[model samples]
Every structure is written in structure tokens, then in C-alpha cells.
Target: MTTKRIIPCLDMTEGKVVKGIQFVSFRDAGDPVQLAKQYSDNEADELVFLDITATVKNRPILLNVVAKTAKEVNIPFSVGGGIRSVSDMQLILRAGADKVSVNTGAVTNPALITECANAFGSQCVVLSLDAKKVAPNRWNAFINGGTLDSGLSAVDWAKEAVRRGAGEILLTSIDMDGTKKGFNLELTRTVSRAVSVPVIASGGAGSMQDFADVFQTGEADAALAASLFHFGDLSIPELKRYLSEQNISIRRDV
Candidate 1:
């Protein structure tokens, strides 16, 4: 079995790392490059830098920070937000991002996903989804940094995204964002089963048990958390140690 991954998400706004609950009332976290280097030097399996407001602000991703952070980490790093075209993906990849995640832009024009995957190869295209539970076991995809509901079925979109050549899914639970309760296991499992590509579960990670639950019960390939890691509530190595004790094979050497 492939070892489950533990990733640290760096939600950035205005070139500064920030974290917010349910995607609002944001607070400063730290510098993106510093956090990237910190997670890289630690045991984090991967790092994700999401320009959370880039799309809403109509600005490009912070490439300068991405370049600096990319130099700090040896592990895979993904950059997202304000990525609307194939050229944007190319620029980010050239700026040192191993993968480019598209959310609002892809929802506005899904062909962008195909174009990016075709040009950069499927491995470099990541579909970042912000979903909220509109009904029981049913989620609606959100856009514009989780402010607008796209009226797209989250599960259906995941399948279609993979069919369109998206290599991975970054599934974030809008209801669970920074909730610290636990992941939306039903949503994660539904999307994971709907797509062959790996699903990275985002939001609602509180404790070590939350991570274990998402991986086992949710059958998630990876669990992503920002506030927990950013606030020093838990460290990647400590989380991996806990996962190891639970018999969930994870990369501890990183």
C-alpha cells in the first residue's frame, strides 16, 4: 500500500500567510517562505501554497515567494489561486511549483484543466475544490475563495475533473474549514471513490485522531491541515509518529 501523505497547507493572502475559520475572519500566520522552509526541514511530506484571494482580487499568484519557498523545500510543492490559463500554469511551474491547483478558474472554464494537463502533463495539474454540504451526503462546489456556490455537484465534478485529465484533487470542506472538529468523511470518501486520482483531504483537522480517522475511515490518500500546523498545535513529525502508532504507514523520514 502507498503510504498516506501528511501535507501542510499555507493559505496566503496579499503575500502573507493567513488562516481563517470557515474561510472568514482571517488572521496572520506568518511568512510563506519561512513556513515553507520550516515544513520542508521538518517531516512534512509535501507543502501547498494557496493564494487564497488571488482570484477574488484579480491578481496573479505571488511568484517571488513561490520561488523562494521552492528553493527551501526538496519535497513536492503545489501553488494555487488566480491560475486561469495554461500560460499561468506554465509560469508557476517555471517559478518552481511542482503542481498548479485551479479552483474558481477551472469552474468558470473546465477546459482550462484539460489545456493545462495537456500542456504540462497530468501530473502537474491539480484540481482544488471548495465544497459545502447543501444537503445530506450532497455537496455543492464553491468558488471565489469559498464565497460563491458554483451549483456543481462536488462528487460529479471530481469525476469529470479526472476525466478531463486533472492529476489530483485537493478537496476542502467549506463547512469544516478551520473547524477542528474532523474532516467531512462522507464528502471525502464520496469524491475519492468517484475519482481514480489521489484525493487530498483539506479542512477540519483538530487532533491526531482526526488525521487517523480521515485516512482510515475516510480512506483518504492524504490529509491536509493549516491552522493546526500553523498555530503549533501539532508538528508533522509528531503527527506522523501518532499515525505510525495507529498502524497507518506514513513517511516519517521526510
Candidate 2:
């Protein structure tokens, strides 16, 4: 069985990691570079650094911060936000990122996904979808840091992105974001089944069972959380151990 990945996300702004409920009411968590090292040292399978406000600000990704954080961790690092073109992705990759995730930029220009995959291989292009449930078993993919709806069905977009050469899908439930209730299992499972690529489930992680549930029931390839790991509510090591006990195949070498 493939070992399920446990990833800690760094939602960043002004060069600092921050967290909020449902993507608002933000508060500082810690320095991105410092936290990157800590999570990498503590056995996180991967680190995702998202410049949450970069698109809204109409700026490029913070390459300086990405470089600093990348240097601190040996694990695979994925950076997202404000990446509008292949050139931007090259800049980020040159800065030490293993992969580049595109959200708003990809929505506006679906061809960008193909361009990125062609330039850097599909494995290096991740489609980051911020999905909000609009009805039962229905979701709309949002962009601009979950501030704008792209009028695209989240599941449909996932399939289209993968067909266009996105190697992975980073699916986050805006409704469940920071709620700590649990992951949006239905939404996750739907997308996971729709896509042929690995799907990383994000949002609503509050406990260890949440991780197990997402993997076992939701069928997510990976589980990602911010404040749960950022606020020390749970440790990656502890969660991995718990998942192992639950018979979830996880990377114990971390």
C-alpha cells in the first residue's frame, strides 16, 4: 500500500505564518522559516507554504521567504499563490521549491496548467482548489484566496486539471477550513474518485481520527492542516503513530 502523507501547511502573509477560521480573522502563528524547520524535523512528510494574500495583492510569490524556508527543510517543499505563469513557477522552483501550486492563476487561464506541466513535467504542477460546498454533494471552486468563485464545479475542475497535466490536486474545503470539526469527507471522496491523481485533503482537521477517517473513508491520498499543527494541538509524530495504530499505511521513517 502507498504510505499516506501527512503535510503541514503554512498559510503565509507578510512573511509570517498565519491561521484563521474559514479563511478570515487571521492571526500570526510563527515565522515561516522557523516553523518549516520544526515541522520538517518533527516528521512532516512535506511542507506547503502558501502566500495566502499574494494574489489579492497582485504580487509574485515571496521568493526570498520561500528560499529561506526551503533552506531550512530537507523535505519536499511546495509553494503556491501569485504564480501566474511558467516564468513565476521557474523562479519559485529555482528558489528551492519541489513543486508549484497554482489556484487563482490557473482558474483564469486553464492553459497555464498545460503550460506548466509541459515546461516542468506534470509531477511539478499541483492544482490548488479552494472549494466551498454550495449544495449537498456540490461545490464551486473558489479563487483569490477563497474570495471569488470561479463558477467551476470543484470536481469537474479537478478532472479537467488532471487531464490538462496537473499531477496532483490540493483540495481544500473552504466551509470546513479552520472549523476543527473534521474534513469534508463527501467532497473529498467525490474529488478523489473523480481524479486520477493524488488528492491532498485540506481543512477541518481537529483530531487524529480525522486523519484516519480521511484516508480510510474519504480516500484522500494525503491530509493537510494548518492550525492543528501550527497551534500545537497535535504533533505530526503523534498523529502518524495514531494512524499507524489504526492500520493506516503511513511513512514511519519520518
Candidate 3:
């Protein structure tokens, strides 16, 4: 069986890691390089650094931060936000990002997915979707840092992106972001069932049980959390040990 991954997310802005609720009211988390190295040492399966405001601000990703993080961390990480073309992905990859995540750019021009995948191979392309519940059992994908709705069904979009060559899906629930309630199981399961690619579930992770639920009930291939780890609420080693106790396969060598 493929071991489920536990990834720590670094939502960044102005070169500092930040976290917010429902994509607003941001608060400083810590230094990206410091957190990246800490998570790496803690045995996080992987890391994700997203420039939260890059798309809405129409700015490029913070390559200096990415490079600094690359130099400090041993595990692979993905970078996203403000990536509009193949060149953007190239620059991010060249800066030491193991994968490039595209959201707003893909929503605006889905061909960008095919282009990035072709340029760097599908494994290097991750489709990051910010989804909000529009109705019971239905969620809409949002773009522009979750300010605008893309009007695409989250599940359908995931399937389409995978068909276009996305190797993985980073599904974040905008409604549940920073709520610390739990993951959006319905949204995650739907997307995970629709796509063959690994689906990384984000938003609303409050406890270790939440992680187990996301993997077993939500059918997610991975679970990602930001504030839970950033604020000393939980450690990767503790979470991994808990997951192992639950018979959820995870890398536990930290």
C-alpha cells in the first residue's frame, strides 16, 4: 500500500509564513526557512509553500524565499501562486522547488496545466484548488486567492486537470481553512474518487483523529495542515505516531 503523506503547508506573503481564516485576516506564522527546516527535521513527508497573495496582487513568487528554504530543508517541497506560464514554473523549479503548483493560472487558462506538465513532466505539476462549499455536497473552485469563484465543480475540475496531466491535486477547502474543525470529507472524497492522481487534502485539521478521518473516510492520499503545526499545536512525529497506531501507513523515521 502507498503510505499516506503528512505535509506541512507554509502559506506565505511578503517573505513570511502566514495563516488566516477563510483566506482573510492573516497573521504572521514564522520565517519560511526556519519552518521548512524544522518540518524537514520533524519528518514531514513533504512541504508546500504558497504565496497567498501573489495571484491577487499580480506579483511573482518569492524566489529568494524558495531558494532559502531549499537550502535549509532536506525534503522536497512545492511552490505556488503567481505562476502564469511555463517560464514561471521553470523559474520556480530552477529555484529548487521540486514541484510547481498552479491555481489561478490554470483556472484562467487550463491549457497552462498541459503546458506545465509537458514542460516538466506531470510529476512536477500540482493543481492547487481553493474550493468553497456553495451548497450541500457541492463546492466551487475559487481563484485569485479565493476572492473569485471559478464556477467549476471542484470534483470535475480535479478530474479535468488530471486528464490534462496534473500528477497531483492540492485541494484546499476555503470555507474550512483555519477553522480547525476537520477536513471537508465530502469534497475530498468526491475529488479523490474522480481522479487517479494523489489528492492532498487541506484545511480544517484540528486533531490527530481528523487526520485519520481524512485518510480513511475522505479517501485522501495525503493530509496537509498549516496552523496546527505552525503554532505548536501538534508535531509531525506525534501525529505520525498517532496515525501509525491507527494502522494508517505513514513514514515514521523522524
- Worst ten in a row by lDDT for model 1: 20-29
lDDT of 2 by residue, 1-254 (tens): 67999999988887766774232222333667777887898889998988877753533437877788777889998999888989999988998899999998999999999999999999999999999988777899999889998899999999999999999999999999979999999999999999899999999999999999999999999999988877777889999999989989888761
Candidate 3 lDDT, 158-193, residue by residue in tens: 889999999999999999887889998988999999
TM-score of 2: 0.93
| Every model's TM-score | 0.93, 0.93, 0.92
Query: For model 1, how does the per-residue alpha-carbon lDDT over 149-187 read when each residue is reduced to its tens digit?
Result: 999999999889999999999999999987899998989
Candidate 1, pairs of clashing residues:
none
Off by over 4 Å in 2: 20-29, 55-61
**C-alpha RMSD of each candidate structure in angstroms:** 3.7, 3.7, 3.8
Return the clash pairs for model 3, or none: none
Candidate 2 displacement at residue 157 in angstroms: 0.5
- Global Cα lDDT for candidate 2: 0.88
Clashes of each: 0, 0, 0
| Per-model CA lDDT versus the true structure | 0.88, 0.88, 0.88
